[model samples]
Target: MTTTGPRVEEGYAPVTGGVRMYWRSVGEGGPPLVVVHGGFGVVEMFGDVLERLAAGRRVVAVELQGHGHTADVDRPFTWEAFADDVAALVGSLGPGPADLLGYSLGGGVVLRTAIRSPEAVRRLVVVSAPCRRDGWFPDVRAGQESVSSAGLEWMRRTPLYEAYAAVAPDVDAFPALMDKTGALISGDYDWTDEVRALTLPVLLAYADADGIPPAHAAEFFALLGGGLRDAGWDGSGRPASRLAVLPGRTHYDVFAAPELAPVVDAFLTAGG
Candidate 1:
């Protein structure tokens, strides 16, 4: 059972906030699968994992504004705006029922997109997606300040970090970068009741050793179920939502984990 690995195709779309997104597509073009990169991620950061999962279908890895090689936008960071940008990109690509997958910040965008247009998404996979549960952060404002002051060198030393490093000399700016990202993350984004209405297939993957604990992942799954049950959907013992913990993985490896490939392959195959 050999697979035709992922390939790359350039993609660009303009959105509000004057942001122009740059994305790369891989695989052989079945039902479109869009891969939204994390806040601090670039297109090629998830190359290994995306390529493997994209073996049999089209996989689009996106680079949001101010990340990777994408042009920086003048507006402040907001997941709603980012999600809208994704909506525009996905809308421009082709048609309905596309697979929406997001990692970290990207996952937040995917969740919002699924809620925004459930009809457009066939399957949703959110890897280490952050949520705004009660006490989701510790003095988020102060946390931003701390991360900004410490910079990427400090992040490199901690197991809590999950974003990509700068490819140039501006690595010193990571603290501010992370601070801005954190501010946006801690803002108004909340998956509490929004994602529960989605009836499409949903896969939630979190690392056993991730910064956001597996308990949080389970809680997210439970909350999702509660929401769906309230909406009179299939929120019973056999529902469309699932939560899995990747053994021996951390925040950064949640998406890059080698084990992810086969699991995703099986899931997509079975779903199809």
Candidate 2:
């Protein structure tokens, strides 16, 4: 399948929390949609999705610290820290809340940002990210635990590394990014309570065969008032939350699925 990325207007969002966050924007008119990429990922990873989403509205793609064009800092990498950076970036953009869409590691950061600065997010879309560490499959959890900087040599041959080499501000810092990301993923965490209390609308999209267990995804939807009682003819029983399990997709390719952008646009555009 051939996919083309949107033309972007890129710039740095001045140093905040000791690291300068890099961002790029595409499209015109309509509400802004902040797109956050996954772990060990750059803005290019969402190239196709951004291209599709940008067709109807502004899409702002951001690269977190130690990834892509953003440089590393002394502070430890944590969801809270990433959330703060996103919030700061939104604040710098000017007034009004922007919609947020995140995939994998970026999904967790977006969730935390919604929780940390509720006023900054108009809507939230989390793709393939679990609210708790244990939500992932056992093998996936084990793999995360064993990840370390020692795999740098192996990673050198990966497309992720190649992509980084092409655009990262400091290609030499790839190992550091991997180490910090590993540490973040290895840590145990749970945000069920916060998620359950969220007031803004949320759309939880995941691949049917995601790294996270399907059971966990259902559980998360339950937290959002989904899978409860059946909706009446008028559909009053259903919560504002939405969920979609894309068929024939995996954790790695869900973000690139041709069906995703349209579904997301429908959800975001539908009135509550």
Candidate 3:
């Protein structure tokens, strides 16, 4: 279902703050698949999986503001702001609707984008996403402290520090974003009963070791079961949002593990 493939370089002139974004493309055909990275992550973390996805479809992975290669925002960070960045980027690059894949923070952003711009998304893949009222939100203060202590430069010197370094400078502004993210997570998108509004095939993937435990992820997905069932199927099938607990894996491993590549590939390509 998935295999490694060559990559193509692509650059875009950002509409917001003129921040230039560096994105990589994989594969040559099928619907475009876009990937959004988690907090402290950029495209490189998922490069291998992107390459594998590219073998059958176009895979575009971009850095969020203040992380990876994207420039820092002049304004504060918020889920709305991040979602706006993703919306703008996708809008600028689009030839048509594209498949969307997001993880952790990126996964939340993808959900926001789907609600904000439902028309632009085709298939949606979310890994370790915190659903409405899920009560799992990363603490901005803790993240800020982590980034501050390590120092971006110090982090960059070591392979593990790369992502932390990317978001380090703006650590002070994290609290507000964390608050906003928390509100979204606890309010169920403020609709509480509009899962059908998204109206798109969604593949919910959870990592056993994620910030939100797999059990919690399953609970949130259960709320959306009605919509999935209306769409006809079970788990990733719809009747129930699908659940996969990557054995001995953490939140990041579900997507980045070398051994799980084949599983991920199969999920993305299934029912295609």
The C-alpha TM-scores of every prediction are: 0.80, 0.95, 0.74
lDDT (Cα, tens digit) per residue for candidate 3, span 1-272: 89743758677547455556656677677577889887657687774777767777778887776665665655554566766777777777667777788887788778777777777787777777766534354563244334442354454476544454454455444343334334433343433355445667677777667666666666656665633345435434344234566767777567686644465556667667
Evaluate residue 185 in candidate 3 and report its C-alpha lDDT on the 0 to 100 scale. Answer: 39
Residue range with the least summed lDDT across 10 consecutive positions in model 1: 160-169
Off by over 4 Å in 3: 1-7, 132-134, 137-160, 163-196, 226-241, 259-264
- Scored by CA lDDT, what does every candidate get? 0.70, 0.90, 0.64
- Tens digit per residue, CA lDDT, model 2, 161-227: 9988999877888888888999999999999999989999899999999999789999999998888
For model 1 the local lDDT of residue 13 reads 77
Give the number of colliding residue pairs in candidate 3.
5
As for TM-score, the candidate ahead, 1 or 2, is: 2
Point out the higher-scoring one by lDDT: 2 or 3: 2
Q: Candidate 1: where is the Cα deviation over 4 Å?
A: 1-6, 133-145, 149-179, 226-237
Candidate 2, residue 29: how far the Cα is off, in Å:
1.9
Q: TM-score for model 3?
A: 0.74
